[model samples]
Target: MTILLFGITKDIVGQPTLSLSHSEAQGLHTAGELKEFLKDNYPDMKKLSSLAVAVNSEYAQDEHAIKEEDEIAIIPPVSGG
Candidate 1:
């Protein structure tokens, strides 16, 4: 699975895109699992005030199911004065 990163999320991950191997992709069954994986791999991601996940281009809740063929995106919190 390929995960697109946006805003601070891209900066936190230090990449615009993240690719999961077929085996890894199969291991992640839900958006929440994906988030945990990211946090484990990239601890900085856990520092964000809030994280939003988009699956198949639509915002997904933790319970949202995910699949290897699905499109995913990570969106971090934003703040402006």
Candidate 2:
């Protein structure tokens, strides 16, 4: 699984994208699972109230399934002029 973070999300993760190998993405199967994985992996993100995820260039709902080859991105809310 590959994950990308944009805007402030990149700042949080310290990178624009992460290439998660099969072994690295273990036990992950859905968008919800991905969120849980991130929450467990990075304690900082655990406190966030909300976030958005996209799978394969499209918005992902909780019910959206994830695949090993899917390209996922984590999006954070922003306010800028």
Candidate 3:
């Protein structure tokens, strides 16, 4: 899948994205599992809240079903000070 990953996600994954493996490809193997995947891989993000996500340009939830051919992205929490 092509994930339009952004924010710290890039740092965690070490890249924007390419092809992910099934071992960590949450929804790719079964149902929606973005939250689980993040918590497992990106433990630091566990504290992040009120974050929004978009799948293929549409707002989505952690449990939102993911397709192998879908494009996903995490809408980071914007900060300005």
Candidate 4:
């Protein structure tokens, strides 16, 4: 699975996108699982005050299912004057 990163999330990951092997994402069936996986693997991700998971361009909840073909992105809190 591919995860797009934006704003602070991108900075934390040091890239615009991240790819996870099938085995890595195999156990992550829900958004909550994905969050835990990310937090465990990428400690910096836990620093975000708020992180929104978007699947297919829509904000997803913890119960949202994650599919291999779905487009996923991490949106960190943003502020602008």
Candidate 5:
């Protein structure tokens, strides 16, 4: 599974994308699980107030199921004046 990062998420991750081998993605059945996995690996991600997970280019709730072939993205909070 590959997760695209945007905005501050990219900065925190220090990369534009995170690639997970099939074995690494095996237990991540839901969006929430994926989020937790990210936080565990990249603790800095936990500092963000909010995070959005997109699956197949669509916003996904915690319950949203994810597949190894699905496209996922991490979108951090945005603020503008």
Candidate 6:
């Protein structure tokens, strides 16, 4: 699976996207689990004020199941004036 990163997430991850294998995301069946996986891999992610998970271009709830081929993105908070 590939996860797109935006804003601060991109900065922290040092890349626009991340590629992970099914084994890397093992046991991550839901959006919530995905968050935990990310936090575990990237501790800096937990410092973000907020992070939203999007699947297939739509905001996903914690219960949203993550499929191997689904498009996932980490949308961090944006601030502008």
The lDDT leader among the candidates is 5
Indicate whether candidate 1 or candidate 6 has the larger lDDT: 1
TM-score for each predicted model, relative to the true structure: 0.93, 0.88, 0.71, 0.92, 0.94, 0.92
Better TM-score candidate (2, 4): 4
Tens-place lDDT digits, model 3, residues 1-81? 566667776666677764666555644532236655665777876777665768878888666777776777766675767
Stronger candidate by lDDT (2 vs 6): 6
Whole-model lDDT, candidate 2? 0.83
Per-residue alpha-carbon lDDT of candidate 1 for residues 7-48, written as tens digits (9 for 90 to 100): 887988888999999998888999999999999999988887
Q: Between which residue pairs do clashes occur in model 6?
A: none
Pick out the ten consecutive residues of candidate 6 with the lowest summed lDDT: 19-28
Q: Is candidate 3 or candidate 4 better by TM-score?
A: 4
Pull out the clashing pairs in model 1.
Answer: none
RMSD of every candidate to native, in Å, equals: 1.1, 1.3, 2.8, 1.0, 1.0, 1.1
Residue 60 CA displacement from its true place in model 5, Å: 0.3
Q: Whole-model lDDT for model 6 versus the true structure?
A: 0.89
Worst 10 residues of 5 by lDDT: 72-81
Superposed Cα deviation of residue 38, candidate 6 (Å): 0.7
Error of 3 at 4 (Å): 2.1
Off by over 4 Å in 5: none
Worst 10 residues of 3 by lDDT: 23-32
Off by over 4 Å in 1: none
What is candidate 5's lDDT per residue for 1-81, written digit by digit as tens?
999999888988899999999899998999999999999998998888789999998999999999999999999878876
Instruction: Give the C-alpha miss distance for residue 77 in model 3, angstroms.
Output: 1.0
- Candidate 1's TM-score reads 0.93
Model 4, 1-81: lDDT tens digits are 999999887887788999989988788899878888888888988777678999999999989999988899998878977
Cα lDDT tens digits, model 2, 1-81, are 779887676776788887787787777878998888887877778767778999988999877998888889998788799
